[model samples]
Target chain A: MNTPGHGQEERTGLGTFADNLRKVPRRFIESMFRTGRPDSDRSRNDFVFSNFFLHVQSVRTHRWSLRWSTTWGLGMVALSSFLIATVTGILLMFYYKPYPEAAYQSIKDIHFVVPTGRFLRNIHRWSANVMVFSVLIHMARVFYTASYRKPREFNWATGMFLLVVTLGLSFTGYLLPWDQLAYWAITIGANIAQSPREVTDPIGLTPHFDPGGLQKLLLLGSDEVGAEALIRFYLLHVMILPIALCGLLGIHFWRIRKDGGLAKPEDADRRLGGPDPEAVPAWTAAPRKTWSLAAVVRGRTPAVGAGAENTVPSMPHLFYAEAAVFMLTFLVCVLLSIVSDAPLKELANPNVPENPAKAPWYFLGLQELVAHSAFAGGVLIPGIIIVGLGLIPYLDREKKGTGEWFGGPGGGKLVAWSAVFGLGTVLALEAIAIRFGWLRQWFPGTPQLLITAINPGTVLTLIYGLYSVYIVRRFNSMRAGALGLFTCFLMGFLVLTVIGTWFRGPNWDFYWSPSQWPGH
Target chain B: MSTHSEPSPGKPSRLDPEAMPRRDFLGIAAASMAAGACGFAALGAAKLPKAAVLPSAAKKFKVTLPESLPSGTPFFPEGRSVVVFKDGDRVFAMSTVCTHLGCIVKPAAMGFDCPCHGSQFAPDGTVLRGPAPKGLPWLSVRSAGGGAILIDEGTVVPPGTKETV
Candidate 1:
């Protein structure tokens, strides 16, 4: 109340009655944001610390964290899209019916009848898509920055699980519309769930121990996608997965705080007791200048004597930056929603399947693998990738260039070459796999187990592994090897996803372009 | 309650309540309580999975072939995933469910084409082109005494097994 700005606001408002009306809003603002305006350093710190929502973040953020190039704000964009999806998804729940008979019709009603329903649904769909894309990019950013190295390793593992949960949420939501696209896509998903049969059946253990059948049953709640599966997916998409995501996200954010904020070059420099050539100029000058009371007494805290040398308060700087990224994400999703209607295909018919029934676009890459060998594509390869990605931080223990993109200097060239090598190898392998068939064609009666173990997915994984080892020996650093390996996997995923989405046609047959598809 | 209990030979000990250590007594009591709680939870959970009402359709269905029906053309029964055909005096039904991944296969010019992963099957339910390790399964069929053919989807007949009509 004593602040000059507060008095000036009171004087500018019309007389006592109008001023009384304005007081209500001012009081509301004051009560919610106790630090008011965040004009001074003290107020800025108090602003973030006093607020429940903003408290998870550090009161003062490293300047690097505020830089658009440092993190690209991809994580914030993902969080924004998720919030949009949750809000819109809840709104959709009011109108959506989960029964098979009513589901498709209700979606039609949502599209054409309910006020703002189409726009809301479109936004939900687009934001979910945005979340998936941004999450992938965010992970790539974290990896390229080498932020997962030590003290932040568990967070990386948690992030991988979060990725799974995200994909799970998206996949489960796909079946809610109950259109041909939804039905067929889920059918493909169910089949993928049952892919272990490729190994089980060949070994004659299917009758005794049928894990794939159990998986399929659990996923669909029956033999196929029907009313039962619809309700199950509805429960998962709207409730279970979201709850899991919230819990994991809480850990993810908290871990970042506990790890002494985002990784920076200064941290490694401080550890090594040498001036990092790449360290921000201010960091070297104010090495012992710390504002935290913990600096006085702490055993092995991540930042026992860390200094806030080149940092800005979270209130106006970081908050405004995050808000900008969030707004940009929302704007992009909104524009996409306005321009393109979310697809609603014909009603689901079990009798007549779509010519080339495909899973959700994100899963199409796995589906492409499934075509080669169901067990390999659907189960084994994805399993290996998940476990491998989770183990990355633990495996690569390099401490130099912690926060620099591509782990500083020569890493850029290494990554670029790795990307080219990855893209070329995948393209060549895909061409070979398509033109000349795999083991099944070469050997008239190749066992399913052999094919499952030695398909294109396995080949790609093996090549990536071997090449990564070579890069390690060549560069004599695990980080360089990781950069090479991660780049290759990224490129391979992109290429496969592209092929699956656009190049593959009816009967899962390959074509140079969609235009060349038969009957197109 | 018995005021005195015997300490049995070859057993660690079983005596009056006063003789039992507090730690062991509490541990045993807590374990039993936990077990009881878990048992009740299991009992409640066991009832959740089994549906009170059965699935809408039955496994076995009846279909009558037309007098002038074509020999080789596939005839799909209503609400069923089986395709039936009559060749001369022999009648047979094959499952439309793809052996590869269980997608309902569509009858095609070559034989049957799976839309999910493109596993193809010959007319006689043999794997022509695969990802499908085996072909579409032939369902057991029997005449229902009135030109009506009864197909048992639950039963998988051998590849060439046909009903004589």
Candidate 2:
């Protein structure tokens, strides 16, 4: 058990060197920033000269304990991803061009001409993927540990935003290569992100407006997969997304400090009236020592006697562990990059039309909606989905549970089972339809299915509404208010995502391409 | 019991004095040990850096001619610069380095590509790209001051400047 400072004994007289330097002159002090006394301890000096990786991770170490280290380890994955992206991105910048025609050609040159250009590109691509995945897993860990309970709700929201932005960063980067895959993938993605109905029907004059106009408008600045799109993607991927991520990440970290560090899994049980009598006090009541207070305002009780009185320091065990994880992830990414180069397709030709154009896998859920009618999956379904997701915190007001796993005696089984059952049924039905070729009728040549008659969306929505009603009745019978409401929102998202994936068939069945190229 | 002697006044009390019981001490120790183990495991899981030193056996190629390329054209002359030429296709040779903090710039129809931060560059090596302060640098060329076309890979001319071969 060598503590962090064990190595420092060998360098005890290091301060004398600084003292001698300080005695040298006021002239030197004026040359640099005029500073008074040099508080130059060995560790303090270590902080200044250490590598960039170590610089960011130089937090105060506490007594030997593992709880803080695990959290640190998880956080390090994201930090490492960011670091790798920065380095690889800088290297790639040396070879990449942002113009439309040159973007793809430049990438090709990097692959074929420049020394190790392929390796650099592959690292950047793989690191981006790794970063996104790590962030997601980190979110999951935080949720399962009940870190988002009470005082940390704001951080939770910020985490959610970061998740979206992370995906956005990845999505925007997809189009920079200006190749066929990048172009079609972006087109499909934008088409899937049709404007909300509310935006189109402000006064409700037209319950349904053609999404084509809005879609085109959104793609206006990026008409072709040329300079405009490349520039847009570049700015978004490097500048905009990074800034947003950094800002939110700062707030997220601050929230952890504000909420009183990380919440243990047992916090959920304690919050939900468990037998733990020694609950910590609310953050406001004992603000300075608490890691985060967002949970307290959300009606969670702090662990009793959990104040800073006997608090352990955040030692190197966790920090070292986190550093290791970061290295491992980087190595894995590099290995993947070297082994597998990302797919590079033919130069982008907007004139050529490809069948079964699809969006990114994440948006497959939304694409599933296009199977029903143009309006259902295309216009109406996506609109509802976004609105619902945006208003999640407001819609689901259950306070009894925290994290993915519920607390209390029965442990959120009711909500969990219902969600599983509902989603399971929809998936099963959709799989059956796809397997049976029942959806073929909705293809381009076939007549469009009746909006209400054969639309899977209509049936799914009706089923969901009925389930909601049943849940409400069941809640009344069981006397569960908040839990019931939470279940409803969760169920709604799961259903929409699953159903959206099912119905959104190839091309979104949008006839724009064919209509424009008549007699082809 | 009646015959028992009284305790001495100077001696310390034999009654329990420590705040924590043996069970509590053992529990805390075990918890601390578990935490320490987790930290160690996490540290152990870190990945190591790959060997990045350039191989000694690698070959090098040199450029011969410094052709006056049009603004938007790419120069992929077999093994030299991989920059794409843009801006109406007359094609001037430009570096693919993104000016905005140096991510390799990709070529798009509108401008140069920045996959890291979306910086755009125009054909004439202008800052059509963002996060970049300036445009890509053009390599200086000389006709070996004689019959040979000698490209000085070391010397770089700023964008928009014309140099003779």
Candidate 3:
């Protein structure tokens, strides 16, 4: 029974034809991906350089890059998810209309009529969630590994821009379904955009210099979310953002290559206190391998003259790892898509608002922040975070640990302490805010500026900032301090997001569960 | 690029005829022309938002009060962002647009409740619970010589102002 092809009776007609037909696909893949068998280093190099997709990657990858624990393949997962979303999203666009009166009906038709349409929409949706989640984790991985050091600083900035684009894509897409969820979420978004009026109005500057009004107009294309807003968001979600992402992604990958293919310790060359280099013979006979032509060109190729001691050809090693991650992402998204349909609620009605209307899950944390003060939560905190995250590589210039998780043992301890402090403070403040209420409750008639300037959100931000400063003073290391501050912000965001998603009921009031919600 | 035009730290100001080089002058001229072109383009772009034509529902409409609408009970007119109340012969209309962010408010047992941020307003359009800086605006109302009354949503009347039949 175990013998290969034991049940097969050698067929002369249709079976032989079927066997040959099966071989056609394998041959096609072979022709596309390989110049020859990848058994030798030269063949593997050919496999990488000759293929269009593989050509973007280096001929060889460092051993550190191959470790599952190093990157967890999160970047690969994000890219895979993005690819899936693009394919399914384009398919969806074939049926979707960008008018207020037609959008909801179109979505319903896609759900009920179009063959495999629900599955396609679900895949697009779940993959979008997967992409956002994986991109976040990838950023965390980069931060923890201190991969955004001197040479990769600009790359890190590029990553921040890409992050914003990702969120923008998600947000604009959120309004497309034109359901209650989509409508209210975008309404909240529009309101958040107008939060600058909270400040401008207080100073009597709104009449002459109304940035908030301008923003809302640009975003919605009118005073409210209507046909114009729908068309504008549709244009952005499908065309502009995706194109911008592709351009930025090109720069990101190019920068990665220029930065010498991911950070590693100085001892990675195996000439210092590190382990002995692999015994495999070199691809080229030079004592120190280099891309001579690339080095002679205008820009410096850092990988050139970097000895290939503990590196292997990327064709099978790195390619296999990347392909495995892609498959995993695809499998997970498909499974989730099959099990759960993407949400499509009642048609959007401006006259009726969903009780406790909430923003998309990713922005729920900011919504929770908005509960304290719209300006502080919606505008100021997000502004600070974007600017802050982008400036991290520049701010934390210490070069002690470049490729280690949590930047080594001491850094891990700092992250733990910071996380605990951040989570504890946020929880306590939320509880107090819920129980005793904020400045508005305690001191009625408080000016909007005072309320906007000082709330739980601002207080938490100030605490985290000062704590980060103190950590820097105590440890005398910018990396350690940056680690602390980043961890704190991350923890706070996670906690607030959870509370906003689950605990807040109608009127944004706290409830233990959905069962406790009024009229539920 | 500006090195030629920069005065050295210890040198006196250059007041000579050739103080600004031809290269610098030409560069400035080209840049200014480009800047002027951009300004004109921006001026044209600014006109895009003002919307030459606006399609909106009639701001003033006649609303007939239902016989079943109890005194002091709010009655919502079809296809309008307004709530009208009648008590005996006195009648008033209030804009349902939430002052916080212009969300349409739903009438509650007590008053109007905003669904956007939970800004509540009293029966007389006074602020009850707020992120709403002010209460809902009272719309101008006038008797139309029949059971019907005209509500002008485009016009804002003083708070508590009412029209008598």
Candidate 4:
């Protein structure tokens, strides 16, 4: 191989030796070990590929501008969670004995003996919380942007499942501390799960055995919150959830390729012939060939026009920006973790009762349901809502397409207003019921009222059912295209209600105990 | 470059048009020389620091002294140490915490080694390797009452100080 500029003869030294070696089947090794000059494309690629921090980024396409931000946001959250898990997990590992007796004491050691142990644990706890928030927000962004439409629908569905798993991961991890807060919170959560089924036989000849009691058995692996529960939760949190998330994430990325980058509404609408094709090219050419799987999947045949060959790949710019955003987000998570450690209450003493047993904030929506009749709010409602959310893709059925591709400004308003009025009415009515003590009639007395009032399961079911009806009606009225806009209000309301309940304090309590049975 | 004088005669003057005025020529020459000198000074300054110390001979050590080194003293040229003293005996030692990436700094002449990224430190623990922000920390030591060496691990003196350890 001739050396450029320095001359062919000049390559007689190490340069020629390297060139000669390149002829051998050691190309993979050469590439693997190669170090390029800084600022060169090769070097930047290497940096992104090899570096741990940068590797998670390196997304391929630039078709969707905001899509990059979404991916970046999600990726940052994941990276931050990983970092927190690593730091806290390692610190925790030092003191965390997997055995039931040792687990609690290990946590104590982490709090007392480890240098900055509390800080590490807090960061891990808070980052886990923030990761859930980010992942949800990322999903919402995808939904609002219509990123889940068409070919990407399966990935979107997978993402939704991942979101649930993420929350589950956070919830399960919370109990590992084994303190009073963790214990009671999980207890309340499990009971809420049992409430609906528990009352099924009340009208029957046999004494009604709470079907919901099964939840306790399943969650705790026994009658009460004890050693078994802690180990079960720990294994789920550390091992199960991470594996599920990793698998889903793989599918999510692959779908991006299969579905074609981010959905551009203009291009999507054009494909369906709802819009003028002359206004833009039939298909938006991906920014770069290298970043796109288009050629491999769709074949190299030219679909639109000639000049498509010259486009630059999206890898260097848009993907780079995504990386920058991820870094920024991770930095924020670290800052938050360092500043706020998750509070751990006094150790669990089963004999003692903390007056207002609270559930995790996410579960507060369900707690709110318990304010209604226990059967309606605690059992039937949440079960229905979870089932409904899981079946959203099948139920909605209208092919709206993905991202910005399904364009139009029609009928969205009617759907939006309908959902706003319907879901909004349920939340408002529930709030009113709790404040005015209207649901007390069903419970018989204070104990009964506490059991029945503000049942989140019921409230969620009612809301989901009503919204589903409104959605179906709106689409039947030819407002299908505007579902995203219509649904936005309900989403906002749910968020507001959750936030409100979180800040509401003691008066909003809903957990039950045998001694504090209704009518007491 | 010669300039011919004008022929003195009634017939014609033959002074070359290219001959510049004496004052203007002198001014231009002086300006050019001044600019040249400035450029040379900048070049010299740029190269001076690197040339002054041979890269191979750069001294780096962790300074741990039983006796207190004053604030301005250079302990190790580029190393860091934790110093402790008992009764009359003074002892100081270096830690291996790498300045970059928070990895444990390893033992080197003046300072430590960063295993994670392969950053080298001078004996005084100044970064001999790229990517590190600063040098190793110097454990300051001072003689307090009762003849005990008061090792002030908290105070870090800047590099290149002239005071003795």
Whose DockQ is greatest here? 1
Name model 4 segments beyond 4 Å from true: A1-29, A33-60, A66-83, A99-101, A203-215, A268-314, A371-379, A395-401, A405-424, A439-464, A467-471, A474-503, A507-520, B1-165
TM-score of chain B of each: 0.74, 0.45, 0.78, 0.37
Q: Tell me the whole-model lDDT of each prediction, alpha carbons only.
A: 0.83, 0.53, 0.83, 0.52
Q: For candidate 4 chain A, which ten residues in a row score worst on lDDT?
A: A299-308
- Global fold similarity of model 1 (TM-score): 0.86
Task: Choose 3 or 4, whichever is better by lDDT.
Answer: 3
Every model's TM-score: 0.86, 0.54, 0.86, 0.58
Sort by DockQ, top down from the best = 1, 3, 2, 4
Flag the better candidate by TM-score, 3 or 4: 3
User: To one decimal place, how large is model 3's interface RMSD in Å?
Assistant: 2.4
Misplaced by over 4 Å in model 3 are A1-39, A50-52, A269-279, A283-306, A408-410, B1-52, B67-71, B87-89, B143-147, B163-165
Model 3, range A111-163, lDDT digits (tens) per residue? 99999999999999999999999999999999999998878899999999999
For candidate 2, what is the DockQ?
Answer: 0.01
Model 1, position A402, has a per-residue lDDT of: 81
Encode model 1's per-residue lDDT on A386-421: one tens digit a residue. Answer: 998998999888877788888843478999999999
What DockQ does predicted model 3 obtain? 0.30
DockQ winner between candidates 1 and 4 = 1
